[model samples]
Target: MYLGRKAIPLISALALSASAFAAQAETDLKFALDWRYEGPAAGFLLAEDMGFFAEEGLNVTIDTGTGSVNTIPRVASGLYDMGFGDMNSLIKFLDADPAQPVTGVAMVYDKPTFAIVGRKSLGITEDPKSVEGKTLGAPPPDGAFAQWPIFQEVAGIDTSTVTVESIGFPVREPMLANGDVDGVFGFAFSVILNLKAQGTPEEDIVNILMADHGLELYGNAILANETFAAENPEAVTGFLRAVIKGFAAAIEDPAAGAAAVVARDATLDPAVEEERLQMAIDMNINTPWAQENGMGGIDAARLDASFEALKAPMGLTGAVGPADVFDSSFLPAAEERMLP
Candidate 1:
C-alpha cells in the first residue's frame, strides 16, 4: 500500500512537469514577407490573428520585406526563419549559390503573377512582338524582371530591339502612368492597381500575364532556412499548416483578410486593400490547378519543365534541379489545404 501510494504521487508529479514543459516549449518563428503590408499579405497576418500559428505551438513574427529577390538572401543569411518569396527567384539564388541553406517548403501562388504591363495609349500592344521599339521599365529586384530572359525566349522578343530601362519599384507605375516609359514589368495585380491609383484608366492599362504567354514558372512560395528546417522539422510542418489555414481563411472572407492587414498597419486604405486582396485571390492565388490539387502542392513534372525552361534565361552555372529548390514533405494533406 505504501509503495502504491508513493508511485501514484510520482506519476502525478511527472504529469505536472510535462504540462509545464509544454507550456514553455513554444517555438518562436520569425517570418519575412516579400513586400509592404499589401492586401496579398493578409493571409499570414490572418493566420496569426486567427490563432492558427498559436495552435501549432509557434510564436510567429511577420515583417514586411523589400522585394522577392531580397527574401532569398534574407532567409539564407538566417535573418528570418521563413519567408514569402518567388519560386523563380529562389531557383536563381540556388543556381548562383547551391550551398545556400534555403528551399521552398510550400507553394503559394499556383499561377505566377509575372507580367509585362504597359500603357496602351503609348502604342504598346499585347502582342509580344510589338515590344520591339518600346522602352520597357523594369526594376532590378522585380521577380517579373528576373524572369525576362525566359519571357524573351518564349515570347520570341528580340532584346536588342527593345529598349530596356532600369528603374526602381516605387516609381515604376508612376513612370508608366506619366508616359516616361512605354511598358513596365511586375506582378499584374500590383502594377494594375497602382496605375489606377495614379489616375491611369483601367482600359488604357494593358496587362500581359506571363503564364498566358509562354513562361511556365511557378510564383511565390513559403521558403524556410534549410538548417532550421532540418533541425525543427515538426516546426516547419506546423508552420505550413498555419499558412494553409491562413490561405483558406483568406479565400473564404477577403474582408477578413484585409482586416488582418489593417490590424497590422492602420494607415492603409481598407477599401483599396480589400479589393487588392480579392484580386490577388482571384488572379494569383486561386487557380484551376489550385482548385484541383488544393493549395501548397505542385505538379512535379510541370515543375521540372519549368526549371528546364529557366536554365538558359537564368544562365545557371551548374545544374540546380527542381528537387533542390522545392521540398514538399512539409505540406499538409490536400483535403486540409483545400479552399473553402
Candidate 2:
C-alpha cells in the first residue's frame, strides 16, 4: 500500500522522531573494573545482560583493569567515566594531591578483601606477627600492598622486619604454593582459591583478613570522576542504581552470576568462577554492616576512623576527611538498595 504524498511526509516525520528518541534514551558510559572477568565481576555483567543498565538509560562499557590501585588514576585522569577500585588507594591519592577530582560513589565491598595468605608450614598464622622476617611476595600494583603500611601501623608490626619481594600478580600464588615465598599479600578470595586450585590443601593455608586484624578499611567501590558527576549527576545515579540491582540479583543466585561472568569470558572455569562469586559474597559483600545498613552506603564513623588509621601510615601532606574521599549523594534510596 503506497502512502499519499501528504501521508509520506507525516510517516517520515514519525520515523525521524522515533530515531531521535532511541538516540536520546541511552547515555554511553565507560566503566573500569579493578580486575579481569572473575566471580565478583559477574554482577556487573548480570546487570548489563538483565537490561538493568539499559532500563536506566545507560550504555555502559565495562573494561578490565590492572589492579585497584591503578583504577584511581585511570578514572581521575578521565580515561574512564567510572570504575571499581580500592577506596584506600583513592584516599592516599587524594591525600597526596587533593586537587584530583575523584571520589567513591558506592561502596561495593563492605569489608576490605585485603589479606595475607601463607602456608602453615611456613609458620604463618592468623596473627599478623607471623609475617615478620618472612619474604612476602606482593605485586607492586596490588591494592593490598599499598595498604600493607597501614596494616603494619594498626598491628604494631615493624615493616623493616619483613622482607619485601615484589612479584607480579600472575605468579603471586604460584610462588606461595611452590615455597618460593613464605607468604603473599592479596585479596582473600582470589589468593585462597588460586592456592587451593594449585593443589594446596585448604587446611594448610592461613587466611587472615585485614579487617579482623584491626584494619578498618573499606574495599573496592564504585568510583566516579568528579567532573562527569558534576556535569551529569543523573548518569551517576542511574549507573549506581543499576549496579545495586545487579549485585542484589547476583547475591541471590551466585551460579547465575557466574554464568554472566562466563558469558563475558568463556575461557573462565565455571566451577571456579561460581565458587569465587560465592566466596566474595560471603566474605566481602554481605558483611554484618551491609546486612544491617544495606549495601553501597558507607558508615561515617567507620570511614572517618579509616581515614585516621591510614593517614599517618600513608604519609599524607595534608588532612583529608571522609567527605574528601567519598560522596554518597548519588546513592539510591536505602530501601531500593536492600539486597534479597
Candidate 3:
C-alpha cells in the first residue's frame, strides 16, 4: 500500500512517537561493580557495549565500586539496583539482618579469589604455615581480608604468631613491595598483578588461595536488591541473561575483553588487563563445576557447608541460611549461561 504525499508527514510523526515510547519502555537498572574497570569487569562492559542489555529491554548503567565488602551495603540501601560483590560478605550481611533488601542472584566467581599473597623472598612460601610470625598487611574493607579469621581457622594458621597490620588499600601492595610487610591479604589476581607492576618478580610471589586450603566459601556474585527483584523479576532475569552473554563474549576472546576494559579506562595497560582477565576466567569464572553445570548457579550442599564454616568467624546468628541469601530462580536457563 502507498501513502499519499499529505499522509507522509503523519506517518513519520507516528513512527517517531512509537520510537520514543519503545525507548521509554526499557527497564532502567543501575549496577555496581565490586572494583574498578579492569579485566575481570570486561564482561559487564562488553555486554553494555555490545547492546546485549538493550536487546533484553534493559538500560543498565554500571559504576565502579570501592570494595567487594562495601558493595553489599550499597545494594542493601537501595543505592544500586544490583551489584557484584563477595558472597561471603553477603552471607554475613544477611546473617546480621535477614530483612536487609539484598540477596545474591548469580554466582560470578565460582571459586573465591580470597588469598594471602606474599613474597617468597620474605620467608613466605606456598605453605599456609609459612605466614606464621610474619607481619601481613590487610585492607580493612577488602573482602579477602574480611575472610582472614575464617582462612586462619581453615588453613590451620597460628594467628597467635602472625601479625596483621591494618593498612589502606592504596598502601597494601606498596608496603609489601617496599618490604614494610611480609605479606598481604587480597584477591590473588589483583595482588599478584599489582606486585608485578611494582617490579616484583612473578616467581617470587606466592599466592596462597583460600579455596585450595579447604575454605569452601564462594566468591563475588551478582546481588540484587530484594525489593527491586520482587517488583521487577523479569527485569532481573533479563539483566542476568545479558550478563551471561557478556561473559561468554569475554571468555571467547580475552584480548577483546581487555580492549573493552581499556576503552572504559584509558590509563590501563592492554597487556596487563588482558592477563588479568585471563586469570579471572581461568581461576574463577570457568571452573570445573561452572564448566560442567554452566554459570550463575550454586550447589546447595556447598553453600550449606560454607555457612557452617562462616558461623564462628562471621558471628552468624543462624538467622539466615543459604536459601535466604542466594536465589538461583532468577538465573537464565543452563544452556544460555554456558560459557565458551
Candidate 4:
C-alpha cells in the first residue's frame, strides 16, 4: 500500500525569498503522506490536480508514509519538508526529541476517524455493544491499537474478554469474513471504505464509531519541520491556503475529486478516496471553528480538548503544551479564498 513518488531532498534551511517563491510559483514543495490513498488524503490529492500547489509556486511531490509515527524524525533529518501525521505522533516526537522541531501547518480530520467494524454475519449491529467478547483487528500494539484497552476502560467494552490483532488494513476484511477475526478498530475513512470496496457489502459490516464510545482523536495534519516553517512561514501559509481550497473542492464534488485522484495512480483511489472526502467535508464543514470562522481555523478550546483527552493513557501528562504541538503562525486566514 505504498504510493511513492520521486524523492526530493527536504528543505532543511529553506527560507522562501519573495524573489524565490514570489506570490505565484514555488517549485519543489515536497509533502510526505501518512498512508497510501486513504480518504483523509483527498485534500492533498485535490491540491495537486487543481494546480493549487502550482498556483503557490510549489512543484509539489506527495510520497506515501511508511508509518505516521516515523514522519517526524524523517522531517527533522531533512528527508521531507513536511509530513502528514496525527497529533499524538507529534507529541511522541516532542517527548523523544524536543529539538526534532516540527509543527502542524493544517489539520485534515476535525474529529477522530477511529471506528470498529463487526462481521455482519454475526448480527453484531443487532446490539453493537455485544463486541465485548470479540477478537478485534488493530494495527498491532502501537498507538492506535493500544488505545483500544483505553477505550474499553471508559466505554465499558470489557477488556477481559477482548483480543486485538495488528496485521494492518489489507487483512482486516478477509480475516473477518473468514471468522479469523471478529472486528477492526481504525479509521473509517480508510478501513471501512476499503472493506466495502473489497466486496464486503455495507450490510455485511457493523461499524462502531469510537467517538460514540468516548474515544475522540484528531488525525490527518500537515506538519513541517520547524526549520522549514520558521524560514518559510509565508510559503507554508500559502501551501495551507491552497490545500484548504483542495478540501473545499473535494467536498463540493467527491466524484470529480476521485477522478482527479485516479489520474495519479501513484496516489489514487476511487471509492475510498471519494467516500472519505465527503465524510471529512460533512464533519469539517460544520465544526464550530470551521463554521464561525471558516476553513483551517483552529479554536484553542478544540485543541485544548484534544490535548486533554489524549494526555492520560498516552502518558503525556506533563509532556508538551499547545505552543509545542501546533504553530498557527503559518495557518491560513479564514478570509482567504479556498481552492474551489
Worst lDDT window (10 residues) for model 4? Answer: 6-15
TM-score of 4: 0.83
The true-versus-predicted C-alpha distance at residue 14 of model 1, in Å, is 12
Clashes (candidate 4): 6
Write down the TM-score of every candidate.
0.92, 0.96, 0.97, 0.83
lDDT of 1 by residue, 1-340 (tens): 3667669889899999999899789999999999889899988988899999999999999999988888999999999999989998898889888999999989888888998999889987788777778999999888888889889889998889899899999999999999999999998878888999999999998888888888888999999999999988999999888888898898899899988888888987788888988888988888888888888989999898888888778887655788899999988877888877
Top-scoring candidate (lDDT): 3
Give the number of colliding residue pairs in candidate 1: 0
Question: Candidate 2 lDDT, tens digit per residue, 222-305?
Answer: 999999999889999998989888988899889899999998898888899999999999888988888888889998998888
Clashing pairs in 4: 25-57, 26-57, 26-58, 28-59, 140-166, 245-339
CA lDDT of every candidate: 0.89, 0.91, 0.93, 0.68
Candidate order by decreasing TM-score? 3, 2, 1, 4
Candidate 1, clashing residue pairs? Answer: none
Q: Give the root-mean-square deviation of each candidate in angstroms.
A: 3.4, 1.8, 1.2, 9.3
> Comparing 2 and 3 by TM-score, which wins?
3
Clashes of each: 0, 0, 0, 6
